[model samples]
Target: MHDEGEPGDPDNKSVNSDPEVQQTLEVVFEEGDIRRRKSSLVPSTAPRPDHRRRKTQCFVHTLLEKHDGVASEDLNASYEGLAQERRVDKDPHSHAEQSQHSRLLTKKQISDMAFGIRELSKKLAQIKIMLHVRNIFILAKAHDETLIKHTRETTDWLLTKDESYRVYVEQTLEKNRLFDADGLLEKNPNYRGRLRFWTNELAAEKPQNFDIVLALGGDGTVLYASWLFQRIVPPVLAFSLGSLGFLTKFDYEQYPQTLSRAFTEGITVSLRLRFEATIMRSQDRENASRDLVEELIGEESEDHHTHRPDGTHNILNEVVVDRGPNPTMSSIELFGDDEHFTTVQADGVCISTPTGSTAYNLAAGGSLCHPDNPVILVTAICAHTLSFRPIILPDTIVLRAGVPYDARTSSWASFDGRERVELNPGDYVTISASRFPFPSVLPLDRKSKDWIDSISRTLHWNGRERQKSFKEWGS
Candidate 1:
C-alpha cells in the first residue's frame, strides 16, 4: 500500500528508516502545533543554521537547515560571517563582485552565471545608467535601415524618448506593410505591426540631458553621428545592420534583449578609440584673389573649404589627401612625434586609430590595430615611391598634408568615412588624435578580435579552405 503521508506522520517508515538517515532527520514538533514541525536535518555536530522558506520561485533548491523559528545566536553568527569573512579578490571583474555575495567560484562558473543573467540584467541596469549619463544620446543615419529595423524589434519604452520614430512607426502601422530592399513583407495580422526605426541624432538634440547614446547603423552611420557629438560623445553601441560590418559587432536579431540590458539593465560598457582631424585652409596672402582666380577657371571651392577659417575640427579616422576619382600622383607631407622620425611621403597619407586601422587603413594597406592601444596608423593611399610604408605612431604626433597649386583636387581629408573638408590647391590638412573619443558598449562575449572575426564572417573577408577533414564539414 502506497500511503501519501503528509510531511510528518506520527508513524512514518521512511524518516527513521536508515540509522544514518534517522540521525540526520531529526523532527522537532512545535510545542503547540503538531501539524507544523521544523525539519531537523542538521546534526548536533553540524554548524547548519535555520533557514526560512522564501518565495519558491527564487530557486528549486532544498535548503539544508532548520526551517522557520530562527535562533537569535545562529542568525547573528551567520550575519557576522557574511559581513566579515566575505571579500572579493582583486581582478579584472572585481567590479562584478562589488554588489554580489563573495563566494569561492571558478572562472567557468562565473562566466556561466554571467551568461545566464545577462539578458535580464541589461534591462534592469539601463534605467539607472541612462539617468547617470543623462546627456547621452542615440543617433541613426538615413542609410542604416537594418539597425533601425531591429532597434524597434526587441525593446520596450524606446519610443518614450524618440517621438519622431514613434510618428514614423504610426505611419508604418497605417500603411500596414513593409518596403525593404528585397521587397515588401506579406501583409497579414502577423506582419501588421513590427519594428520601429530611429536615428542617432536624437542624442545630439538635447545633448546635456541624456546619459547614454547609440548610433544605430553601419560604420558610416556611426561615423557621421559620432562627428555630430564632437568632443561631447556619450557611450555608443554600434548596432550594425549591414553586410560590411567592421566597427559594429552587435547583431540585429538580438537587439531588443541586448538593447534593454545595455540601456536599461546595465550589463556592460565599452570604450572605443577615436581619431580626430583638423582641416586647415591655405594661408596664402592671395587667398581671396586665388578663390576668385579659381572661380574664373570654373572651379568652385565652396564645399571644399569652410568659411569660418579656423580649420575643421579633429577627425576620428585617417587624415587623407589623395586623388578623388582622378588617378594622379600626390606628394603628401608627413610628421613624426619628434622631427627625427619625420619626413616620409607617398601617393597620400592615412592616420588612423587602432579601431580605424581596420577600415580605410586596411583597404589602403595599413596594419590592423588592437583597440586598447593608443596608437595611430599612417599609410599611403598608393605610393609611387618604394620608400613609403605604413607607419605606427603614438597618438601624440600631428600629421599634415598640403596640396600645391599643381596638385589640385589630388588630395583630400576624411574622418572615419564622414567626408571632412577636402584638400585642394593651397589647402593643408592636419591630422591628430582628437581630445574626444567614442565610448562604445561591448557584450561580455565580445572584444576587438571578435570584431575582426565578425567582419571576416559577414563580408567573407578571408575565407579559408577547410583545413579539417571533409567528413567533419558538409555532413
Candidate 2:
C-alpha cells in the first residue's frame, strides 16, 4: 500500500504496516474534511482558519496553555469558543492596510480645513484697516498771493504723501477753475483722485460731515472757518501764513512731519470759548428816557439808516459798539446779569472773550488773559472819564450794553471786525456764552511751552532794551 510516510524507506514501511499509523492517518483525514465543510458554510469574506488560529493564540489560547493540569480537550474547546466570539465581535474584512489608508485621508482633510480658516482670517483683518481712515476738509485764505501759493503747495504735498486722505475745498473758489482765483480747489491737473470741493450754500443746505478742518492761512482764516460751521466746528489745524499769526503758529515747512504725527499719534486740542451777541430796540423809547435824553430828543434821525436788529451774531473775538460817523463820544450803559454795572463814556465799548484779550482788547489797555481763562473782558475805547477802566468779569454772568433811551447819538455794533449794524436810541445788545465752542488743534509740544513761545516768537512779548545793563548805566 502507498502509505502517507517517507517514501521507499524501511522505517516508513514498518510504520505503515503498524495499526497505530493507519489509525492516525484516518483521524487526520477526517478532521481535514470537517474543516473544509465548515469553511464552505461561512461567507467568502469570513476570517480564514489560519487567521482564526493566529487570533486565538494571541490571548486565551496562550494563557490557558501556560497553566499546568489543563487537558488538551479543554484547551481545544476554549480555543474554538474564543476564536468564534472574536470573529463575531469585529468586522471580518477589516485589515491593517485599509485602516492605515483611512487615517491618512482624515489627516489630510483636517490640514486643508485649518489652512482655509487661516486665509479667511487674514482677509477680514485687511478689510477692517481699509475702513478706519477719516476725511479731511481744507480751508485756505483768499486774495493773498503768498497765502494762496503756500496753501496750494501744502495741498500738493499732502496728496503726494498720503493717498488715504479725502480732501475738500470751498466751492466758491473752485468755481473759477483757477487755483489762484480766491484760492479755490479747481480742476487742476495736479490734483489727485481724492480731491473735491464744497460750497457754503451746500454746507448750509446739508450739514458737512468732515473729521478735521485744515486752515492754511492766518488766524483770521481759521476764525472764518469757525463761522462757516455754525452748528459744529471740527478740530482745526491752523498754519501761519498771515501777519500776527498768534493763533496760527504752525509752520508750513514742518507740516509733513507734524501732520504725520497728528494722524498716527493723535493731536493736542484746546477748546476755545465762543459768545453770542443780540441787539434789540427798547419797547418804550421817549417815555423811558431817564438819562442823556436832551441830545437824542432834538436830533433828526434818517429813516433809511433805521432797521430792526433781530438775529444773534456769534463772536470769537470781541463785539465793538462804537461812535459810527458821530462826532461825539458814545454814551454806553453796561449791565451784568440785569444789574446796573456801569456807564462807559468813551469812543467805544468792547466786550471780548479770553481768546480776544490778545486782539483789540490788548490795544485798548485791557488785561492779557490766558486763553484757558473762563472770563469776559470789558474795555472802554479811549474813555472820556478817568475812573472808567477795563474790567474782567466771570463768564457765567450775562452782559447787556445799550444807549440809554437818552443817549446823545447812535452807535455802531460790529462783530469780529465785520457785520456792522446801527444801534438807534433805546437800543440794547445782550451777550452770553455760547453752547458751541471752537476746538483748536495744538502742537504736540504745547504742554511744555504753555503759549509762551508763541508770544515770544510772534508778538515779541518782552522785546526791549535789557533795562540798560546796570554796569553800562553809569558808563
Best by lDDT: 2
Query: Which 10-residue window in model 2 sums to the lowest lDDT?
Result: 23-32
Tens digits of lDDT, candidate 1, 1-475: 0012211123311121223221111222222222323675556897665865554543224344345686533334454344333221112234433422112122333223333323222332232223222222445543345544553342223543332221122223223223241122242222222233333354334333334456566777667656666655545677776557666768766766666565444434444545544455554454544532232112442233321133345355555666655566665545331122333345567777777776788889888776666676878776877777788876544444556555444466655555645666755554554434455666644542576685577657668797875556665
lDDT for residue 39 in candidate 2, whole number 0-100: 43
Give the TM-score (vs. native) of candidate 2: 0.63
Model 2: lDDT of residue 100 = 18
Task: Show model 2 residue runs off by greater than 4 Å.
Answer: 1-133, 175-193, 204-208, 283-309, 465-475
TM of each candidate vs. truth = 0.53, 0.63
Query: What lDDT would candidate 2 get against the real structure?
Result: 0.61
Report the alpha-carbon TM-score of model 1 versus the true structure. 0.53
lDDT of 2 by residue, 1-475 (tens): 0122212223211122223223111101122212345646867697766633343546656665443686555345454344322211111134423521111112223223224323332232222111122456778865666665665666666666666565666655554434553332354444545676777864444333565678987878877876776545666788777787878858877888877776665555566677767676544434443442222222322121222336566678889999989999998977764256877888999999888888899999998887777778999999998888789987655676778766789998988888899987767676766544566777755533656777788779989877664655664
* Most accurate candidate by TM-score: 2
* Per-prediction tally of clashes: 41, 2
- lDDT for each candidate structure: 0.47, 0.61
